[model samples]
Target: MSKLLVKLVVNALFTVPLLLYLSNATPFQALMASLSLSILAFFLGDQWILDEFGNAAATLADGLLAALFVGAMGTAYHWGLSWSALAVIAVVTAAVEFGYHLLLRRWDVRWYS
Candidate 1:
């Protein structure tokens, strides 16, 4: 709950601005995309992959997932985000995810339970 909220806030802080600047998306669109991406990343990357595959693998998986997810959303929404721009967004988000995974490790939240 708290972890998910924090992740949402952090992801929105990074994603919304990037989407607005890079894709010329409206604030509502950017925020919706950010929220959707955050939920997907939290469940798949932070919850499952992080527990099963460890940090480095989880980070890489998260980055790839971010790229794919955002790319799909951009296309669907006609946001016109380029592959290179998507890469930049994924890299930045992955960097933050790396630190976030570390924090999750420290907190030892009952992700499964």
Candidate 2:
């Protein structure tokens, strides 16, 4: 399998357990926070995988898509059919992820070599 696929699988494996734990602790909101954090981490660390494949955009796109799909799954699992709650979760996740990236960029933190 390709490196990007491997990365996504690994990330999902790590995320699911973490989400489970968080869900147990704070319920659905914790799951949303976990997804946000995972996406931020993946985005910050994407350059290393991109350099390996020579396709930064592709790697980033895949990561974001995976994040959204996972986010939706988590939302569904935790919030059920509550569309309004799901919408709030989505917005908070995006905001947190974007804020994380912005802070990293402002600090000039090079997450990936």
Candidate 3:
């Protein structure tokens, strides 16, 4: 699939359940956040990190960004803080992303080499 499609799929894969588990989360809020952050990641997290290092470093950076975004939802929604929730979202996202990036890494290495 194309990069854009992959991003959408990844965002959907992670974001939907996250919103579901958050309790009292609005789909609109979740969607807006995902839309904006996915764009942010496309630039700040993905392109920048990839240029600065490699896929592994980008993965780490993406995880951090994802974690922060997930953690911030409580604050954004005035639902107070939920550290455990944030940690779960971040870890799940990171694990999923790591696998995705591994595929990308293989393709990228082959494509580049």
Candidate 4:
């Protein structure tokens, strides 16, 4: 539950602004998309990859998955999606996620087994 809370907050803090300030998404749209992506990342990146391969590997997976996720969501909303833009977002998000994982370690909090 704590982990989920972190996911919600962190994802919202980053994604909401990115979508709202930088893209065409409304606040409600940003909220929905952020939560959706956070849950998906928690399952795939934290659960499936993090335990097995550790932070670096999991972070890499997160980047790739994020690119795909943001792209799909952008398309769904008819935002002007582009590879360059998505790549930039992916890099920034991945860096933040890497730090977030480190914070989890510092807090002695594990999101998954």
Estimate every model's Cα lDDT from 0 to 1: 0.89, 0.46, 0.68, 0.81
In terms of lDDT, model 3 sits at 0.68
On the 0 to 100 scale, the lDDT of residue 16 in model 1 is 91
Compare the candidates by TM-score and give the number of the best one. 1
The candidate, 3 or 4, that scores higher on lDDT is 4
Q: Report the C-alpha lDDT of model 4 over 20-57, residue by residue, as the tens digit.
A: 76677778887898888888888888777877788999
Candidate 1 residue 45 C-alpha distance from true site, Å: 0.8
| TM-score of candidate 4 on Cα atoms, chains taken together | 0.87
Mark the 10 consecutive residues where model 2 has the least summed lDDT. 50-59
- Over 3-91, each residue of candidate 3 has an lDDT whose tens digit, in order, gives 64687678767866686666456777777767666676768755577656767777777778877876676577864437777667676
**Which scores higher on lDDT, 1 or 4?**
1
Ranking by TM-score: 1, 4, 3, 2
Per lDDT, the best of the predicted structures is 1
Q: For each predicted model, how many residue pairs clash, with residues at least 3 apart or on different chains? A: 0, 0, 0, 0
Give residue 47's error in model 3 in angstroms: 1.2
Q: Which ten residues in a row have the lowest lDDT in candidate 1?
A: 104-113
For model 2, state the Cα shift of residue 87 in Å: 0.7
lDDT, candidate 2, at 57: 42
Between 1 and 4, whose TM-score is larger? 1
lDDT tens digits, residues 1-113, model 1? 99999999998999899989999688999999889989998999888889888889889988898899889988988989998899999999899899888888778956435
Residue 64's lDDT in candidate 3: 82
